[model samples]
Structures are given as C-alpha cells and as structure tokens.
Target: MENALSTVSSTLLSFFNSQALIAAYDVEIFEAIGDGATSQEVFEHCNLPESTGHQLLVAMVAMGFVEYRGDIYTLKPDMAPCLLKNGTQYMGTLARHASKFLYPLWANSAQAIRTNSNQRKETFGDERKWFDILYSEPNDVADFHAFLSVLADPFVESFLKGFNFSPYKAFLDLGSGRAALPRAILAANPHLNVAVCDLPEAVDHMRQELMSSGHSDQVDVYIGDVISGDLPEITQDLVHMGWMLHDYSIKTQKCILANVFKALPSGATFIASETPLLDDETGPTFVALLSINMLISSDGGIESTTAQYLDRLCEAGFTNVRAVTLDGPRTLLIGEKP
Candidate 1:
C-alpha cells in the first residue's frame, strides 16, 4: 500500500520532472555543463541568477540528468546524446516543442475529454485546425519535423532490417516527414526508384534536406495531401506512410486510407506505420497517454488497436491486410490494392 501510494504521488507530480528538464534545456544548462562546471560557472555561462540556477542544478541532479561531485556538475554520460545540441539524438527540440505547445494544450485535457473535442480553441484561442496552428510558424514546423525524425530513427532502422524493399521497382512514401524512410530505402536499394510526397509547405523543406544530404538527384519530391485527395499520380509499386494515420479522427483516417487507395495503382503494396494499443485495449502506457494528448491537441486523433487498424485497412478495399511486427516501437500495417 505504501509503495502504491508513493507511485501515485510520483505520477501526480510528474510534470515537475518534465518542467525541470525543459527549463534546463531552455537555459542551456545541459550544454553549459557538457564539459563539467561548477554551479557558479554554469549559472554564469547561461546568464542565469545564481540562486535560482543553483536550485535548478539541484533539481537536475535529483532527476539524474546531471551528476554533482567535487563542487562540479556534469551531464549524465548516457543522457548527453539526447541533451546536447549537436548530439546525434538531440531531443531539446522535442522538449521545447512540448513546452511551447503540448504543455499549454494539455492543461485543458479534462475539457477535451468531457466534450469529445480538441482543446485548441480553449488553450490557444485559435479556431483553426491543429496543423494550421502547429505549422503557422516556420520554426515550429522545423522543430516539429526535426523531433519526429529523431523519434523515427529507431523505427527506420527496424523497418529497413525487418522489411524487404527489393521486391518493389519503385517506392513512394506518403506524408514522409523528413523523408527519412525514402532516403534510407534509396541508400539500401540504389537500383529502385524512390520518391516522397508531402504537403507543399513540407515539400520545400524536405527537398532542401534531400539536397543537403546529396539525395536531391536520387529521390523525387512531390507535393500532395492524403486527406484532401490531392495526391500525385502514384506509379510506385510500394507506398509507405509512417506514423501519420493516428493523427486524425477515425473518419479522417478512413478518408486518408481511401485517398491512398485511390492514388495507388493495381496490385500496389501500401504500408502505414503506427503505435497501436494492445489487443485488450490496455496500456502500452505511452500510446494511451498519447491518445489523451491527441484528444486535447489534435483533430479527434486516437490510438487504435492493431486489429482496429487492420479492419480499417480491410474496409478501405485493401486486400491481404495484416500487421507486420517490426523490431521497433511502431507496428507496420500492410495491405495490397487488388
């Protein structure tokens, strides 16, 4: 009973942990201590007042993000990759994104649940849709996609290993944020034609990224919208949409699937990657919490079970609909247009 109560109490005050980490990122505390620094040095480097900055250091130490010894502090070795600005798995963008948007929106989660609607208007006084508000600023768009790419890294590695791209002559990734998958596929199967289709606002950035990565000539970029049915004529034999299906209402998901179905040629393979709930609708913990985040911040987005996703695929006139297990956080729901 004592342990259970302690867990509950910790859960209730979890936001403190999140805010402390975010605050550290905001003040560049992690970067300041990257090479080890005394509290005074860290505060001076970040231009933070000594009293509050010392308090934050103490909090970071307690949170295990920093280690304090011999009057000096250092970023935890394991956490450096995620905390440092130039680290391979830098997550400061995600932390800032949550601090700027998700934190405020989630404050109205109760109202969202009660009304079965998004809390965008309540939180931001913006009546526009989620993406409109989220993509309103260029920095926000960059941060959003940057964090998504970081998060997708693991899934991309797993997908490449677990799935075969050799069977298809041409591949197109729909709503490919950062076009990570297409880029990876092109690298692995240099002979196969690869392309990416995304919203116009995102396409320019993706094209620029491809150019920077020297894939501009290798991979084709097209502007398209799956929900609006404005997709380009997809001649690709295989189409992959990553972590996008759970971003909208079931009705809209169906519509997106239908649109993708219409765009693909006969006998084409389609794959949508998603983090689904367990079969019993119990917690995968993160997916369940993400469902609430979607409720408050998105257009009726909710996590579905694998079975639910397969059923939706089947209903959209997809044949051989099945869930493919990958060695990553996301499940790949695959179907073929007959």
Candidate 2:
C-alpha cells in the first residue's frame, strides 16, 4: 500500500512538472530566437550557462519540445502555441493572472482550511485594484475573453446541454466578453435573438467577432454596465450570464443579479454558470484554486456555491431556481422569474 501511495505521489509530481514546463513555455523562452537561436543563444536569452542550456535543450528535444537540426534549435509544433504571443490560442494572460496573484495565496490552502474564511483577504485581497483592471479594462478583459474562448469552449459545450435555452425568444448576455457562449447558444438554437451587454470597448470587440462568424445579423451589442442602466434597446426573455457571478461578494452578487432580474421579462430565465465549490469540501482543490483566482485576480470577487446563488435568486424575486452541472469545473444556476 505504501509503495502504491508513493507511485501515485510520483505521478502527481510529474503532472506538476508538466505544468511548470508549460508555464515556462508560455513565457516564450522556447521560441526566443533571433532568426532562430543556437543552444549558446538560448543560454544567453535564458541567462543560463551554455552547457546548462545545451543539457536542457537536449532533454526538451528528447521530450519532443524542440527539433534539433544542424546547429539551430527550433521549436516543436506544440511548443509554439505557448511560445508565440497571441499565436495558436496562447493563453498567456491566464498564466500571468495565475502566477501574479493566485499562486502564492494557494499556498495557504491548509491555513484556509483551518480558518474557513474563504481566505479572501487572509490570503489574496479580494477587493484589490488589480482585479478591477482584470475585470474592467479593455485590453486585460480582452485577454480574459481570449483565455476563456479557449479554456471554456469544451466546458460550455458539455454544460450548456444540461439546460434548455430554446424556450426564450431573445437573450441578453450581460458582460459578454467575446460572445463565445452566445455564439454556442446560437449554434445550438438558431432562433435566439441575442443582445450582448458590456462596456463600449467590449461591445466593439464583440461586433467584430459577430461579423467574422457571420452572426452579426443574429446578435447585437449594448454598451454600459448592466447594473447601472437599462439592459439595451431591446427587452430580453433570457438574461444569460456565464462565469460572471463568481467575481463578487455576496452583496455585490445580489446587486448584479437584481439588476439582471429587473431587466429580464416575466417567465424569462436568468442563466449564470460558475464552478461551484461544495460548501464543505475539506480543503484546496480546483474549485478552491478558482476561488483564489477570483481574488487579487479581480475586484468584487468570490466563488459562491449553489446554495448561496439560490438564496440570491430568491431574494431578487426569481422563481423556479435550478442547478445544472456543466462538466468539469463549472455549473449553471438558472433562475426563472415568472
């Protein structure tokens, strides 16, 4: 049994090593070439000794990360995705977001367990300014949108099947970054007339995406925070919010939901999807790590559970609440106001 446990531990270590390798690759060290670089050039770029770089490059090549052709060290096919910024779905922003804010705070998982504070302020400051930039700034938010377009695509496909968006004639995607979910929703149910609500910059970006996908005729963008004003020129039968509720405290979450609830028509569905952490999980895991990501990573943050969301929906005058699981790391909390 002890040998089996050790083997499991070693396997987990290899996974962590792979994560490290990926993070390093995201920083572009692998493809940092001046018309492509030699091992000595790589050493200079990485600020490491020539011999050490050679050893590392040889191992990476053996591990299928690089191609060794004559003297020039070239990146392998998969390595270029992370190495080239904005190339081949390179999600460098999420990496920067994770490393800059979430990594160190996750170290306190044990302490967070001991004190049950959600470790919001005890570790990373949940109300910090950096998160504000992440959430509200155009470029940072675009990075986040790009990050999600890749990371959440598979999850959306799986989870969206759990709830039926077909009943609603129109949808208002509040805080819709890249229109990824709405795009999927349209693909699934072609009848939906969608309006995306976000800042002006985001709306502008959304327009370009809608045009590219030939979905411009099906959807429209509305500029302005949903909380501050009326939703859009059009009234929506379904108010869809994907992965936005987990970025606020209970009070702010309620406020946002109330805003959404008010904009939606009677019998309309308010769809909110998040990675719900069961209320009494033992300690740090993916959901807990995500809770940390909500902090210093963004302002007005949290990772609320199903129970909490249910209460908020009820308080905001939503009826017939339902929790639907979206595969792996996310779930949909849909509230219908009738």
Q: How many Å off is the CA of 83 in candidate 2? A: 5.8
Candidate 1 minimal-lDDT segment of 10 residues: 199-208
Give per-residue CA lDDT, model 1, range 1-338, as digits (tens): 99999999999999999998999899999989988999888988999999999999999999898998999899889989999999988889999899999999988888888999998888899999888888888778778888899899999999989998877999999988788888888888887999899987788778878889999889989998899999889999999998788899999999999999998999999999999999998889999999999888989899999999999999999999999998899999999999
TM-score quality measure for candidate 2: 0.73
Query: Best by lDDT, which number?
Result: 1
- Please give the distance, in angstroms, between residue 117's alpha carbon in candidate 1 and its true position after superposition: 0.5
Over 3-79, each residue of candidate 2 has an lDDT whose tens digit, in order, gives 99998899767646555555555535565652468877787787776665676677667767678888888877666
* Candidate 2: residue pairs that collide: 131-298, 131-299, 247-300, 247-301, 248-300
